[model samples]
Target: METVEDVTRMRLVGGNLALDFINTRTGPAAGPPDDDLLTGYPALIAWGVHAGALTRAEAARLRRLSRDDPGRADTTFARALSTRDDLDEVFRSLAAGGSPTAPALARLRDHEADALAHARLQPGNPFAWTWREDHTLARPLRPVVHAAVQLLTTAALDRIKGCEGCSFIFNDESKNRSRRWCSMDDCGTTEKIRRYVAARRTRARQ
Candidate 1:
């Protein structure tokens, strides 16, 4: 049985997925950071959290994988981040959802198979295997994460926001919904302080 801790960890990791999707940088330099783009499993799980599917503990565990076993980090990251055609087909099938043809379902199944195989190779606790564990419990977790993504993407795909300073995604659920950055502590504070100093200089010029 999975514990509360497991779920929480996964949530953190899943949240990153949403963040990676936005990639909100500006100018010629506008691109995902190497770390955010390269870290795969954690980001995928983090996407789940941002979608409100996985608990925090579950997300955290996914995060821990990169730290605990750096060896598999690049490989797992690549696998997780790859935007394969099959995934698109899966999404199409999911959207349609009326006993999708075997070929379409097979595409999704193959994608999951590859993902599960990669996940199993990475080192972690037994629950980590739940992602690839081929068990009753594992089966449900997969769709829960997927459904969370689908729900968020469908409802707020246009409004979904990402941080310019870092790759983090969050729903613009604020009453104002004008959120452009991820957190006040990170980029927000830095940008505000810089602007304050710049404004002070302009006032002195006057």
Candidate 2:
């Protein structure tokens, strides 16, 4: 099946799948109006595929499901995005050495239960996991919960970082853990050029 839509404008700079979902609402794409990357249900499906949350066939199936009951699909899509923002806040708080609010943790627990409802052990490894269906609307968000759980329980929390250029969150996987800016070639370079131009202008004014 053909793609539901083009998601080439969506940036996949986040080091993790959950981070990719959070980064969606942060960066504006190039072009007129420069809208949010996940603008609607179709856009969300495309993002899921681009971000490795879903395969092309899975995305196509989700596209059909969403179109079948557009209202519920829209509501679910909105809820997923809202959860993404909440996750962003929760992660930011945790990364800053503050505890997540009860409600935040509660919400994550809810997502965790829902995610597990459709999960199954993979064939070869009892430890390996897999989702039951790709067409489910919220299936794309299951990884977000899993990723969040991993960071909350492991050393990765220490690597959580905010991009100085645009405030997008990413995991710092560099050897020195010095990664910043969701994408060095994009936001990083853009900000560097802006600062350079401003400094040159200031020097000329002196």
Candidate 3:
């Protein structure tokens, strides 16, 4: 009964991990966009692959498990979408030049704790933190939860930004820190065309 899109449309323009996770929805956060790329368990897993939270093999395995275990898979998908929305709230406050309140911060911490409760210290590069879960369909999202916690606790929030063209969040990591737009090829181009058209229209009217 569930409709699914195998290809992931989630954008990865956000320069930071958490911001990239939130960019999955392509339009206004509240309004229904053309489509939510994260439509089902497969979509969530696909996003996981795109976000580097899971390898191709891992994502493919999770997708297969979703079909076999629809009941728990559905619940996992729901929780992933819910966390995505809650992250929107947490980052929205930061993007608006305000710190997340105590309640908001608590919610983030709760999610972080819940995520790690399912993870363990994964060994790899000494500088990296990793975990491997054999059966948690929702395991991929734990990295995102941790990424959110990292951004909130560090000075990374200071570089956070929203695209004026489409409200897609990103980090301005330019040398001068003046970068904007989710991407120079997409939203940036659109805004340029918009401004050019506006200037031409004004000249014609005058």
All candidates' lDDT scores? Answer: 0.45, 0.74, 0.77
lDDT of 2 by residue, 103-160 (tens): 9888888887888787786777447567745347787788777777766777567788
RMSD of each: 11.0, 4.4, 2.7
lDDT of 1 by residue, 82-177 (tens): 433334333323333332467755655555554455344435663343353432212223543343344434654434544555544455556776
Could you estimate the TM-score for every candidate?
Answer: 0.45, 0.83, 0.86
- Lowest-sum lDDT 10-residue window in model 1: 20-29
**Candidate 1, overall lDDT?**
0.45
**What is the TM-score (0 to 1) of candidate 1?**
0.45
Runs of candidate 1 exceeding 4 Å displacement: 1-29, 36-77, 83-148, 152-154
Q: What lDDT is obtained when candidate 3 is compared to the true structure? A: 0.77
